[model samples]
Target: MAFFPSLNLVARRLGMYRSGGKGAWLFLPTSSLARSRPGRLRPFHAAFSTSAGAQHSEEENIDHESSLGRAGISAFKRAVLARHSTKAFDAKREIADETLAAILALTLRCPTSFNVQPYTVTIVQSEDMKQKLAACMLGPNSARVLQAPVTAVFAADLDPVQLVPRVQSLERRKRGLPEAYLATLPFSVAFLAGKGHLAHAFKDLFTTAMSPLQPMPSVSTLEAWSYKNTAIAASWYMLSCSVHGLDTCPMEGFDGRRIMHELHIPASRYAIPLVVSTGFAMPLPSSSPERNEEAKKSPRFPPEAVVFKDQYGHAYKGISQL
Candidate 1:
């Protein structure tokens, strides 16, 4: 797949080019970075308040935990830089159950819209499901999905809906924000209810239930939330994979409607927004380049373009009076 280089991102990360609307990258001498101790330069966003988080696209709070230990940083840097999406997987390669578990465990810790925790992880490693998934995604993707060692499909249950009111009431109390107001938060955090509400509540009332309707509606919204929530989780998992010399590909171009049906999930109970295909890479052809030149230049926008002062449109890089 052609990596659509977002000019804005390129300009910000690399500081070399600023075509389109991208910000300019300045030459920060190696001396300057060396003089500045690591971890001391607070990520600009980290220092900004919600007053700022609200204005700019609120990037996630990356509370990094060094699971890699003393040399973990170097290893992590290696993993991230090397990691890339692979639509094609070698059929001979098998994804160990333990490795898959390790990856999913990382995702399970993914932050939810609320503490309500509304997503489910479905690892479709079954040959049956893989075939069905492949069929669903259509020709090439199906072949890839079937050949791939593991396909992790993310779903959302209506379980969070039940707690919405309660969560909302608490949000209002805790932060003086309205109940269910988190929907306005910068990311895809969501809440939904379980199916038990109407069934169980009617019996308790001891009245012949007049309504036989399902309690929840709008499966798309649920799936969308799960996609965002799990995408973040999957991002961390991919990073973990990179460090361990494993490979991962986050793919959504597949046919999700077919996957939901093939997986035997009810229309109401489950919603799959995205599928992440992960496995080992194929052997490089003898003609393959010694260096992945395009990959090497994972261009980014200049620091000035992304970082700003106290307000929007003001570029602030910690001014110091000499």
Candidate 2:
């Protein structure tokens, strides 16, 4: 009898075998089976499997190597090093609409809890509107806003009822989730946006009690949650601007109430987290050597000072070397 690997053995090793009842066998190319010798099983390689399996294996190898490669690391490091908060922007320079749109597109990919993006970015481009927004800013920030050709206001939607369920349903549908799963979105939203302080307090008590047994995320008010998620998106927006060769000044000195009124955004529904001005940076004068040196030496706390090994206050081994 010609020797062949058992179907079970082939399935365990190759994971490309077809499934069926009693007489089913691993499908190897006829040439391979024919080449098998009596009383000696031939070893199988992934190259000998189905084309789909070979292609899948190739893709997995490529993805694994690329993820660990230095090219991606160097690019990300460059972006981080290039990013800085510009004190002044060139008034004559303007970002192309397409570039701005691309930056916003990447910014929208920032992660949010439960994938509910509870934020809106209002773009201010008109000179009249920019002037009005500048009036809403305080001191030096007001000048920066007016100097930049474009400004974006990042607002967190305090009321989840306005956006949560709709966004959840759309995202779920794209993933081809079952209707039964999608049906739970409204209830989930209601739980996230608890009915009142009394309800939230009760829920928090229950989760806090359960914390010793398993992991539980602390429940926070909707306003707090919205601000947390919106801030993440705003951070991503600044990085995206840097990657596009645009300088940004993130200002929190704006009058939120006045901005809401000027933009016709209802204060009850949304809260401004940050306002960012984006444009080409003003060129530094050659005469200001001392100022240029200060700009180059942007200070930061050492990693050892901020990062712990496994617990708070524990020294991270070899971090000082880094």
**Most accurate candidate by lDDT:** 2
Predicted candidate 1, C-alpha RMSD:
19.6
lDDT of 2 by residue, 1-322 (tens): 0133353453433322333333222333333345534323322221221232224545665755346468877877667677788889999988999999999999999987556688999999998999899999998999899999999999998877667567656856665543433443443444565547886786576446534534444678877878898999999998999888888988899899999999998898899989999999888888866346346446777777778888988867666321
The global Cα lDDT (0 to 1) of model 2 is: 0.71
Global fold similarity of model 2 (TM-score): 0.74
Shift of residue 246 alpha carbon in model 1, Å: 1.8
Q: Report the lDDT of model 1 for residue 150.
A: 82
lDDT tens digits, residues 1-322, model 1?
0123453353234222222433322222122334544333323212112232232322344435636575867766667678877747788988777777776676666666554455666788878778777787754666678777887777665545655566556656765652112332222122122245453343223112211321221223344545566567667767766665666666667766677788876667666666777788776666766246364334666666777888887887854321
Candidate 1 Cα misplacement greater than 4 A, ranges: 1-70, 163-225, 290-298, 307-309, 315-322
The per-prediction CA RMSD against the true structure, in angstroms, equals 19.6, 14.8
